[model samples]
Target chain A: MSDALPPGATLGILGGGQLGRMLAMAAARLGLKTCVFEPAGDCPASHVANHHFRAAFDDAEALTRFADACDVVTFEFENIPTAALDAIERRVPIRPGREALRISQDRLTEKNWLRDLGLAVAPFAPVDDAESLRAALDRIGAPAILKTRRFGYDGKGQARIATPDDAGAALAAMAGAPAILEGHVSFAREISVIGARGLDGAVACFDPGENLHEGGILRTTTLPAALPHARATDAVLIAGRILTALDYVGVLGVELFVTDTGLVVNEIAPRVHNSGHWTQDGATIDQFEQHVRAVAGWPLGDGRRHSDMVMENLIGDDIARLPEIARDPAAAIHLYGKAEARPGRKMGHVNRRTGPAA
Target chain B: MSDALPPGATLGILGGGQLGRMLAMAAARLGLKTCVFEPAGDCPASHVANHHFRAAFDDAEALTRFADACDVVTFEFENIPTAALDAIERRVPIRPGREALRISQDRLTEKNWLRDLGLAVAPFAPVDDAESLRAALDRIGAPAILKTRRFGYDGKGQARIATPDDAGAALAAMAGAPAILEGHVSFAREISVIGARGLDGAVACFDPGENLHEGGILRTTTLPAALPHARATDAVLIAGRILTALDYVGVLGVELFVTDTGLVVNEIAPRVHNSGHWTQDGATIDQFEQHVRAVAGWPLGDGRRHSDMVMENLIGDDIARLPEIARDPAAAIHLYGKAEARPGRKMGHVNRRTGPAA
Candidate 1:
């Protein structure tokens, strides 16, 4: 609590995507100014941030200048360059810390870390070359997914091996990058928990949301996932355990597979997740504000859900339906202000309240 | 509507206060960019807006530049200079229009207009010199108030006429400015309705909230004001009538005194009102977004209440209690990012949800 930044202090954000934009707005709501560091001009975050430092992450001089301007630093994405983090860490503290980023940055590392923590995770093995790919396939079996060990998101950098004959093409899909083979797990549904940890080590988790994906991209998330009371409590407890383990001081998104036996960890996001977007409309305090509060060393706000909500993403050309969506009284629209609507690009989202929370 | 500004269009704001700041954030939520024109640097709105034009209202060149960047223009305050509005009107339309501002800028003009529209208002008379002041006092009786016709807010530009003998001092307090004397009306409480009208002439009004003022500044606004169902309906209807008469295309605040016989119109504001701040946390659609929707020619959102909320303003030294307030799980804090907490300055506000709406 003694390290708590005052209201007018500056919070530096690493990425200038839609996540950063929403984070900047949330920081502004708490009377904090934000400076965004991104290489591109007119990035979504720059539109709302107090300051924008447009430079490549590898530029040490620009990183120092950006770090010098902020009282505390946080990031919107986990893939920020290690050199940039190293430069900023020398000047100001980064919440969720380097360890959380270190683990979440690579698939192999994240899987090993979760498994070592006694958490149930999908069977996985690392693949650095063709020979290793064959070994991993033999261990994990066919019907596996080969993914780039790093820098993969939104169903990108992934190839499926339907049978033994498909292993060669799946291995070639790696394109000389380090990869990981993950065995498919039979699950009833997918769910995610948005969890937060304060500077004082207090943990809070929002209720799990059931997620639906299309073409390897998230399409919708509905709150109060169909789970028994005990299982719901277990999901929240699992999220809290992870936050406490990392000594995390910001919001984290943990995606889970609700199997017939138990919940299995599919992946974990070090920053705010698209699945948690419903909190903006259904809960008392949203995940963006929760992250800002944690990084700023403020107390964790109440994350109780007040309404049942369904959050649907408006990807790419789906934005053409804005006129009709705008007419829906139940929908709360949020757009990223992107100029082009390329296929699969996340244009915005709409949170529609179904009713009061059960 | 054909005039509807598409997403990514810039909205020009006249004032850079907290209301402007909130408006800029709301516009950003709807995928609209904002450019704020204010004389002061580092104003609240400037922190969130996409652009900040730092120039006085009378600076025609700066006003023109600001207007050139915007598809539509709106204002956060009513006292914007006529020349500035004239310059902007040539390039783009200003929502709520100039007629609303013309009547609201002067007390005498507003009272006359309301009365002519068959609405009940306090007995008022125009006063210029000593002779007129005396005549107004003789007609309106003692225990009245004399206020300057323009540029008055938060109880400034006013003097109490406690008795007939106090008339000379009250007149002198006007500083030779045109004035209006308003007769006192005994009332149980004060309530306000926030209403909006779309470009298509559709009107929507939020639930009225009872207000409490101290030192002539608003302190708190609580939803579900103590009023009969019919009286509340009447209050909302009165506000809709005012908006329809003016052909207003944004939010308007109508203050009413709950008297023994009926509700009396105390004043009308042609912009988002402080009392409506509760809607940010209590309703499905807040006043700021509603105003943005109206001005942008988008469909007006439903203004239905979702939770019971009490919005308390943190004025001046009241900001010192932030630590305690931040610890309250029920409080949703909104700070204006002001560097100094000067006396009587509005630093921020907190909306506390007591429970779900009844």
Candidate 2:
């Protein structure tokens, strides 16, 4: 409580995408100012943030100024440069800390760390080069994903290995970057739990949402995921364990594969997750605000669901359907103020409330 | 729909108070940019707006710049100077139009217009000087209130005349400003209807909320107000008539007195009102977004209430209880980023949801 940042304090954000924009808006709702640090000009977050420090991640002078102006710092993405975090950490504390970032930044590290924590994860092996990739394939088998250990997002920097003969193409796809071979796990459905840990060590989790992806990007997330009472409970418990183990002080999104036997860990995002967008309209408090509260040292808000919701993303040209979507009485639309509708880009989302939460 | 502004278009807002701040955030959520033209430095809306033009209302050069940058302009307050609107209207359209402002800015004019529309209002008469005050007092009777015709809010610019003997003092208190004398109406409770009129001549109104005021400032507004279905329908009908009569565009807050016989119109605000704040948490689409959607020439959003809500204002020193309020599991707190909480100033509000809407 003594370290809690007051309402008027500034929160520095390390990215300027839609996540940062939503985070900035949530911070504003709580009487907190936000300063966004991003290299892109006229980025989404800059539209709402009080200040925009538009400079490269390695620009020490700009980072210093941004850090000096903020009382606490957090990030919307996990891929921020380590040097930038080091510069900010010298001036203000960063919630979720460097440990979560270190582990989640690399796919191999994240998978190994989850396994070491006694969590159920997809069978995986590290791949450094052609030799290691070949050896890992022998153990992990074909029909696996070859993903870069770092800097991969939105299905980027990866190749699918359909058969042993395709290993050459997949290895070439890595382009010399460190990679991981993950054996696919057959699951009934994919679900994610949005959990938060406060500075006081209190944990809260939103109801798990069943997810559907298209082109390796999340397309829709339906709340009150179709799972048995025990399995849902298990999912929440697993998320709580991860948050506690990380000593996390902000919201974390844990994706899980619900198989017949048990829930298997897919991955964990250090910041707010896309699958949790349903909570904005379904829960008492949203993931963005919950993350802000945790990072600011405030008590975590209740993340209880009050409405059954289905959140559908509008990618690129899908924005052309906004006029029709706006006509739906139950739809709550949230569009990022991006200038262009580039293909595969997330332009906005609509959270449609079906009914009261059961 | 043809005249509707695109998502990336700028919506100019006048006055950067909490209402403006919320409106700016809502606009951002809909992928529209906002430029706040406020005289004060570091005002609330500036924190979330895309641009802030900090200049006096009379600054012609600045007004031109602000209006030039916007596709359509709207305001959060009704008392914007006429000259400022004149300059902006020449460049871009202002929603809720000049007629709504002309009527609402003057208490006498508003009452007369409501009455002329075959609606019920408190007995009111124009008061220009001591003679007119005495004459109006004679006609309207004692135990009335003398309020300035323009720029009166939060109980300021008003003086109660308990008896004819208090007339001289109340008249003098006006300081030569044009005034209106209105006889008090005995009512069971105060409630307000938040309604919107879209560019397509469509009308949508939220369920009325019972309001409580202390020291002439609104304290709380509870939804599902203790009114019969018939009376509630009548209230909504009264609001629709006003909107249609004025050809109003954007959201309006119409305060009403629920008398034993029928509902009496108390007053009307051409912009978002304090009593409507509960919509931010309880409704699918809030008043701010509804207002933005209307002014941007988009169709009106559903103003349906999804949950029963009680909105309590944190005025001045009431903000000290924020720490305790933050702990409430059902509370949705919204704070205005004000540097100082002067006496009677609205610092923030908390919306507590009791249950699902009936």
Candidate 3:
């Protein structure tokens, strides 16, 4: 009976991971059932979901069954193949649709879209081979990053080139794939604007959080982020512009490099980002619930924070310290139910809420 | 491996209410598998869980299968039959264990336990027969209540005996069930303490919340409860005592009646209680995760509030208002994925974080 999607409607989730797991949990709190499709068995999302289809993303039969069973589909990761997206769209509504995915799936397109929206992005050029890599390195200069156009995450598929001679090796390392060479921004700090955009064009943004990374893994995000209010406002507006331009209908996280002049768009994650985990314990409505509301065709929630927030990732073997972490009166711990503690894997996170320092 | 139950461990959950549903979601975050055994076919917990055993609680075969699938079994509701607990215990650990359930399942035993623990309780008497009811009525005077000793919840299985003539109707309404008669205290307010107890005897409690009821249904719970610091400590201590006495593991809620004289114990919920829903939005570690930690043998988390809180129930027809509620800048709405919205059913809840009033 809600103006949003009615109860009993199924929400299809693509890529079953901790983000998808949290989103599914939030959706269930609103009378929405979820069917998760992922190739991985015992996916964290599937464990608590209504149903799961454990088939490869490209399996046409499984895709058809998944689309046929769901009313609306959204994804946890932006790297889903366009073929799978196209197939699912024929059967169900795919919010923040295929166009958004296509733009975000490739590094070159994402930078181009941000520039087209009049947002500041680092100088970049597409590099298709060793020849292009050399020319791009000459034009963009040394000490840049070479990232593959697709299927890259968490520092994978990208390499830092400090010398001209490193270009060919970096290109070879990426398997001679379509890649982009981007100039580095010596930013003061990294921050992210976590927000939701509804189909009706409404936008809600949480306060930006200063982020820190260790070995390419997000280590912590602390909020009341060390940014001027004007910069934070600009960051939120930049995110809104991207959402509006793409007709995005769910939560999207925009990573930005805070520079002396202003905020420069770094990259866009079409789904929730690890930086927003603080919202789970620090805000009126967390990013996961906001994403659920957006995809369910419901009204957006307030993204206001009531306290100072810090979310720290429990990576690799850090998970073993959960027992000690649990004793902290100020910390909120969330484990992702992942079985393995291999190197650089994200096992869980903890959020600590504090009053503003005197 | 963790001192707490590790990933791939089977978590046995008793009861199949929305609380269990949420708990299953939380446990899955830690790579835990779940087997939910509830009597209903379409229980809220069954919708997203790994497997569901739809059988009466006393079914031995089903119980054995349930125990076999689970390494540790925790319940959602406290009214589970003791026989079922005995049967399941042969195979798996049942956190909040059988003794806790027995004391909480019956009003008389619960009150006695509270009294024995040196907590103040409303003056109560056992009323198994009409003669005993009359004696209790004469002793306590009018404006009291007669509640069935066992199987009572949400104000069900009880009647107010406002006058001498009303006692007969109240007794008859109880259907000859063994009951307890309690004198009403002129309390200033009602509050509840929600806490978790670990296997290692660590206890953590959220800030108590003031409760409001309408039509015999819990309507709302507001945090930073209208209690002095000493009173809140007393409330938490009462909860800790119950958990310690029962040798309880997992989350437990102790509802309290606040009189001008002091706080009096009202009842105990051996499982997660609705009054604790604020923790889902206001605290660093919500009750669900804490319960998961307890059953999984992990450490209990710090149960401290990060913001002032308000939790409002979405009952039956009220769930239809989710779209509007979702629009509230301050509301974090959550609805159970129940297929139907039956009258008086708890369809969901909305937890809002706000600044404390001046």
Candidate 4:
């Protein structure tokens, strides 16, 4: 509803993690100033953003000051506290809007939304208590995943059920929070599409990335994914449909399962996704910039891949290879500027160009 | 020299113009922090650098404080005050070393240094006064350029001796300052090689970017410069030789005139050059990062061009084309956060990729 932001306008970023760090860097490249809101003193985004508000997300005064200073507000994480949004929404517009966040915050709502749109999704049943867990297991079957309906990320807040007998433990793991039991779709491969929609209703989606995971954490995302041509096309169309349906004006990462039946929707992230990191080196316009553009009311850029790439995440102690990564001329290294590289921590990434640009 | 700077090390930047703005961004990509020293509040680099020292270049107290905080210092311009360097050199190492700056600070010294090294240069004579200017003009021949020995850039402090009769006014233009009169070389094309040398003596040179100038300011620099393959090789080797001769530990810009016989050295800038701007999109590692790496004692990246590119400068009101430039996916637009766009001011640049990356 607002006018397009000028080049020198300030972009207010919520959650100053690696995503926000890259976003701040991208905004700065476009001559836009960024103010990051994060409680941590050493948040990665704080290192690069023009200004930093070191306060709790729900700190009303801090939120007021940050929203007052920024020309536009956009957040990277979906789990942003409703109270925080409530405090800031009165001051500035939030891109992707509150509706997208409300649906994505709960697993059941995301699945139902996809199903309502006539998209294929893994069979899922909501579980609120023990009585419902048993009833849902009967409907969804064993060897399914029971995930908390809200507040989950990077393999957190979820448990797998091997059999019907294991349902109780999975239910107990939810700790009384609402849960969704998703039956395994027998996926051939995991793929993700990073889609963006601009303020003027223009939508763009990158080619699906063949994703690989290690211990439930993303390890690598390779472009030119090994998928049937039809499936790849289907992925982009589905992603665009979701973007348009939500009236989203920022990047959304849609996870998919290449199943025997077809491509099944896994979930959606209302921000730049890890699987899209290859865009930094392999594409003319990267996803971070795309998100920034969409949030600033600028037209969406080409999400087309320019080069073949393998984007590898440098989690935890993987940062020890910084020296080695630096030696390779083709290795486009991006470190989050985090102070410490604790085990299982995401420190940096390397996007290696494996082939020629398109 | 100290060991290679780690990823999180702080790099002190001497200037805060667009060049420094780019250097700070590149340093951030490498997970390094930058502190910029500039008196202006709205300097382009101040918008992105991690820390800023708002003080005059000649302020010894500020210089000492800056050096004390940084791991090492590197400048983005050649005209850094000697007194500032004198104050900081004892506290922190300055990359490219003082010798390169000392030689480049004076046109006569730079030319003589190149000639003494067996490098081809325009035939020149020193002029200290009107009589000497007339004598130099006669010796160097007409249709030559008369340039002040010190503090000259962008066609400033220079005049043309169009004919033998035009010497008096040209001498007066120098205002009795020491000057150099050099006979011009008829060239096929003007080109520049961006070369780098590390503290450990490794050298790398980017492919020459053939340049065009209007009103003495660079208008465009096209890669794959249309030079004979052998001449291009010679350009790189000559750049490397110059880097080694100066014991430089940072990026250097070497301008050359391609004549019928061979290449003739015009001058050298002891920092990142505008001519190398194409590397931002055409190479995996750009010149700014190369400069930062060299100054930080790290290995030089492959300076080989990946994609064919034409880097066009957006000077003055040319920035009004943002809407059009933003429509081109292949245009990597880099805008300096400068508020005013005075005529001849470099407001931004656009690197248009023309071919696939090699």
TM-score of chain B, candidates 1 onward in order: 0.99, 0.99, 0.96, 0.97
Q: Give candidate 1's root-mean-square deviation (CA, Å).
A: 1.0
> Residue A350 CA error for candidate 3 (Å)?
2.2
Worst 10 residues of 4 chain B by lDDT: B1-10
Model 3, which residues run further than 4 Å from truth?
A: A1-3, A356-358, B1-3, B356-358
Q: Give the lowest summed-lDDT range of ten residues in model 1 chain A.
A: A1-10
Measured against the true two-chain complex, the DockQ scores of the candidates, in the order shown, are 0.78, 0.83, 0.61, 0.61
lDDT of 4 by residue, B189-275 (tens): 999999999888999999999999888889999988998889999999999999999988999999999999999999999999999
Off by over 4 Å in 2: none
DockQ (model 2, Cα): 0.83
Q: Which one is best on DockQ?
A: 2
Per-residue lDDT of candidate 3, residues B275-299 (tens digit): 9988877766688888998878877
Q: Which one wins by TM-score: 3 or 4? A: 4
Better of 1 and 3 by TM-score: 1
Stretches of candidate 4 above 4 Å error? none
| Residue B228 lDDT (model 1) | 98
C-alpha displacement of B324 in model 2, angstroms? 0.3
* CAPRI tier for the interface of model 1: medium
**Per-residue C-alpha lDDT of model 3 across residues A1-358, encoded as one tens digit per residue:** 1446776788999988989888887788777888999999877788778899999989999999999999899999988877898899988889877888889889999899889889999999999987888889989998999999999888889898988878778988889689999998889999999988876778889889999988777899998888778888999888888888888889999999999988889999989889999887777678987898888778887687777878999988998786577667677667777888898888888888766321
Global local distance difference test of model 3: 0.85
